[model samples]
Target chain A: MRFSVLGVGTSFVESAMAETHGFADCDMNSQLLSPRLRRRMSSATRLALTAGERACADANVDVSSVPSVFASIAGEIKVTDTLCRNIAGRDFPLSPTQFHNSVHNTAAGYWSMVTKNKHAAQALGAGENTWVMGLLESCCQLRSLTDKVLLICYEEAAPEPLVMGEQISDCAVAMLLGIPSDKKRSVCIYQQRVEHAGASTELWSPVSAALALAKAVRHPQNSSKLPISSTAHGWYAEVVHGE
Target chain B: MKQLSQSIPITAYSAVTACGLGNTPLYMALESGKNCLQPLELFHIDIPTCVGEVREVLPEISESLRRFDTRNARLALATLNCEKGSVRHAVMHAIEQYGADRIGVVIGTSTSGMYETELAYEYFRDKQHMPESFDFLNQHAWGATADYLKYELGLSGPAYAISTACSSSSKAIASAQRLIASGVCDAVLAGGVDSLCRLTLYGFSSLELLSEKPCTPLDKNRQGINLGEGGALLLLEKPDSQHADRPHLLGCGESSDAYHMTAPHPDGLGAQQAMHIALTQAGLSTKEIDYVNLHATGTVMNDASEMKAIKAIFQSGVKCSGTKGITGHTLGAAGAIESIISLLALECGMMPGTAGLTEADTAFQYDVMGASETTASVRTVMSNNFGFGGNNASLIFGQYADNG
Candidate 1:
């Protein structure tokens, strides 16, 4: 029911900025991916890797040694829309790169390829009670399977039809989680209630919920039943000092 | 294997595929050695190939759940409504046995309703906007179908979707197991629903991986894959003495090739690790495995890599076969459909054969079945599904026997 958060990393962009230049603000300067690799990826994936790499550095863990769970709401929607446009236009040849990168697990696959980690990586909706689901996913792996897991929640700024005709902040958050231990300084995350944010349009919202949890992990306070949601989606969790 | 996952009971299951509606037709086709794949008729394709299309006329989503109307959702409904509503009755029973709030739903899909979305995009290209009838959140968005199942079933527990391409549903099963294993939910409706779409067809075609003829896995003259579509659902519950007669999902293992975006590892190291982990979690050795549902997509590279992995895991005599010959490649739903096929094999004591295979590749250390149906006293079966992005998942199911 509880797991330790060893480190957290986040990347956030203003809604207005994300709307105008979703890719211009992308900071792909991380040391984990090469420049060639950076150019080949979508901005959403770059943000995910940037946050995941930073979380690994913050946790002082080798990225190659850990498994991961990459969550997203409208994963690869941009690329998918493009491919659909190509197909509708009667374009004969679909780009193989875009087709392969169009999967929801694109970020997870990229993370593993960069690190050469054979550890199991999972990709889920990563939304709808979005990051809470991500946290629960991490804790489940910790409880039943892996010792350490990298949990990354990221979403691209959805295009017009997919969103509510408004821009949401572009953000990606990553947390390194492990089984709670007295030997390590960590924050204990316990699920208070599972939420289904099914009907909410917050899929395009900023990663504010994930950011709140990361910020809570930083607070030197023992709080139970902390409310975190980007919208009216009801979900609650608690974080306590593990050290 | 750091830990042995509890063998969760599969209380109920149903599937809709090319053969027909429900597991009965699927099993009948497997038993009669029938190839259900036929020439594509659901949609037009420039490429000449056969696909395992669900020939049954799909039901319309009720006006109340019209927002969920899509080929994918309809396929799920067909499966749920199949066999005079066994899976539906099981869900209702589970809700009464355990609180509705204690049940969860997790479905997998490579594409929820990309077919509809692709049509919408065509309108947008011409009209500059989508039709008012299209609701991406309920129809085409990620996790939409899982959410549809949750709301349709009136359950309030955790629900989501896994979208790791081909391994989506198997991973969904693993997540369902985790929900039970982690004490989060008493039961979960876990499986996958994928419909044939132009994107996947064109995508794989552009890669030159589409076999013009029927896909013949493990055949010396194997070409490529014939894409298929279907939905399969399994009700996984916490271990119960009451349901001990049902088959148990022994264990699951997932790994990444970390080798290529689309291609698998040449030596099948990741595939081997996944099989090893699944067996370790099942607390069984290779000798105990009665059959393996190979993830052979009828591609030369895929079969070659998976064969190496098979060689590394099982000895020469272990029975194995690829069902893509009969069903074509179902993409996301392949995992759950094949798992159900394995469960059927255990129940009927009939091992499926390679439907379109003429000759098995002789370079392997394992036994790959041909057109001849092989029946044996099968106890435990393993199914493998490896997807793009190097995602690989293996699941083991065995007949529940307390004495063993």
Candidate 2:
């Protein structure tokens, strides 16, 4: 199956040159959300919303009209840690807002509320393969629904206890994908099942996968295949840049 | 775009909830209008709230799968082990027909083994050292349930976890249908599982959304939701000539509220749109629906908003009920669990009443059943599940008639 990349948005390391890649610095102040809604959002939700807004803006599409698939490896880890800490301390009363925001779909929910987008939204988690799985889900939806799909993959660093030893970065990536209405699309993504051992990259988290896919979309190198995960016979993408 | 609705056959399904161990108990509870809510016993919390805890002893995992052992996984395993492991039987048959690589697994969960994470945190808090056996991937990851199911079933198709709050499992079913429609897989094991943890109880309590008594949806005196724990699984495959008798998943409609994170749209716009989409996709009108399984969480806002949506969709007399009074709100697993209930309603020709409902809220015009009834010849039924972040989903299941 093939799909066209219509727009791309990336939120890299805080100090990195994210604006150069069409992403603004991760800003918590979102004009898309009301002040009340903005105050309740976590860092992860802010990152996802920022990237999603940028993607929609880049594509010049109404965010509310396009269906979205949000993928994350560890969802709202800081909130999870907060709840864990409260429970560990035998704190009888945990903050209700924090608890509700601790769900894996918190970011996705915030996206919908902020955008006022009532379209179908899905929140997915697949460990380190979240981005690829999310891509697969989006492509399937696009094929079945025959509509544009906004795909967002994001992750953030957690506190100490949940962090363990794995080094995680705060980042988010968004892409507007669809069947090209016009032939002038810059890149067409072809999905193929390949032997998982053909080529692989060491990915610490789902954010790396999103960054790699964003890189491919940005550069549009011809005849390039990116392994989505380390699974032996998983699905990989073959990028064909259009002239 | 008007696309043909993919009629996926639910070959096998199972659920383990607070009502009992298997679908049989769940069906019986629904039939008898049983309320399974009980005072908190499994763990201690200072709040005075009731819960729908699974009283049945969960099966112990084998040594190899011990790393994945957790309350949530155990509840999921218990559901799969129901009816002499009917889900496994269906999976094995699908494997024989389609090969393991062609059958995928998609599990929906909100808090996968979060209880284990809470325990690990408690241990660390006291010992100042993380436990040696603490594996985040196996226990705390949101994909842990899917991973555990995949490993246990030995299938290799496109497996992942959906975590769209309460709509997780409902979307999982929709995703499975999409996977089949996209020709990505021949068959998919799709469902949801969520085991109760202190975080959820305290979380709901913190939100003041937990009812001190058993939840009473659509009742004038309703307070809040009574949290529950359960797991439900369904084996979905393309409708073939041989399985025409099986219940068919007619259509799925999903929408985001875009209203609020914790609260629903005041006017139930998203909820109505979701139900509308489901009815449109199913090629049915409001008159064709025999029953509606409401997503009423017993909270004042949820019930009121859902009533508005129901009023906007169906006619004055369309029968509706909320099963949370019987099973409590199962959170992420609710979509699949309630879908199973809707399937049972279609198959058994019985519509479960809204248990614990003393008096219907007079503000709504819809008919909210307060007692179970066996007179309805249920053919097509819709199950509604709305989650946090204003995520809403509605699934329509139709009773299959063998034309052959």
TM-score of each: 0.94, 0.95
Fraction of native contacts, model 1: 0.66
Cα lDDT listed for each candidate:
0.83, 0.83
Q: What 10-residue stretch in candidate 1 chain B is worst by lDDT?
A: B365-374
Q: Which lDDT tens digits does candidate 1 get at residues B50-85?
A: 899998899888888898889999998888899898
RMSD of 1: 3.0
Best-matching candidate per DockQ: 2
Local error of candidate 2 at B52, Å? 0.9
